[model samples]
Target: MLIVGLTGNIGSGKSSVARLLKEMGARVIDTDQVAREVVAPGTPGLQQIIDHFGTGVLNADGALDRPKMAQIVFNDTNALKRLNSIVHPAIRAQLLKAIADYRDNPDAPLMVIEAPLLIETQLFKLVDQVWMVTVDAKTQIQRVIKRDAVTAEQVSSRLAAQMPQEDKLPYAQRVIDNSGTPEATLQQVRQIWSDAIDRSQAQAE
Candidate 1:
């Protein structure tokens, strides 16, 4: 399989691109969903988090309270680093297992690992290519504000906590500009999907 790491800043429409790839018959392992699974109730991951951040980060059902944890970490660099230290390894392990499961599946010629922190977490190293989705800062901010229902300041702070788009661009094998209309973005995704399919077939030969 051709493993592609799909990443971008928050509100850059990485999910949209992932959806397009899925619609194109690519197997997409969303690291965000994997992140949640690793930390679900009764898991060692959640226990470790509780041991570090205390039980306050958990909901009444013993689930990780993501919003509360985000509020705590996004504002504090050390807290965010600490959270990543605990979560990244677990996420990586799950990703590797998923990749291994699909590696020999003939039906899955392309596998896209979609993650917001692909570069930051160094997960891009596992993929054959990195496809970055990008949009203007203004559009990014607006999209995030509207989607997340948070103030501009909140969105900006979260964005600030992440690696800058410019810094990540150098690592990308392909960049998808999502600043335009949905149709335009879809066209870019289609081209990338076609290229990925060609590359995968060549590799198999």
Candidate 2:
């Protein structure tokens, strides 16, 4: 199976694109979703997180308090890295298992791994190709502000903490401009899905 990295700056509709890929019959392993699943209240991953950040990041049900934890990392770089350190390895291991299972089953020719921090975590190196979904800074900040219901400065600060889309573009095998309508974005994804199937078949031969 051919593995591709799908990433984008925050608020770039990267999840939407991933869903489109799923609709195209590509097995997409969303690392963010896996991160949450691996750390459910009683899991070893969740226990490690509580040991690191304390009980403050938990809800009444002992589940993760996303906003509280997000606030902690959004402002502190080292804290963010530490959190990723704890979470990312587990996510990568889980994804590798998923990939192995997919290949063993031979269900599809291609698979996508969706990670918001693909570039930041250096996980891009694991993929056969990278596809970056990007938009200009002005659009990025505005979209994030509107979507997250935060101030421009807050959005800017969060965006600043991540590796910029500009820096990631050169690393991408293809770029998907996400500053358009949902229909338009899906159109691009559909084309890529068909193309990837062909590429995967060639690689298998």
Task: Summarize candidate 1's per-residue lDDT along 52-149 as a digit string, tens digits.
Answer: 99999999988999999998996798998888888899999999888888875646668899999899888999998999999999999999999989
RMSD of each: 1.5, 1.9
Model 2: lDDT of residue 3: 86
Superposition error at 86 for model 2 (Å):
1.3
Local lDDT at 161 for model 1: 74
Q: After superposition, how far is residue 147 of candidate 2 from its true place, in Å?
A: 1.8
Cα distance off (Å), candidate 2, residue 158: 1.8
**What lDDT score belongs to each candidate, Candidate 1 first?**
0.91, 0.85
Candidate 2 C-alpha lDDT tens digits along 94-145? 8878877876886766688998988888888778899989877788788888
Candidate 1 similarity to native, TM-score: 0.93
**Lowest-scoring 10 consecutive residues by lDDT in candidate 2?**
102-111
Question: Candidate 1, overall lDDT?
Answer: 0.91
Q: After superposition, how far is residue 176 of candidate 1 from its true place, in Å?
A: 0.7
TM-score of each: 0.93, 0.90
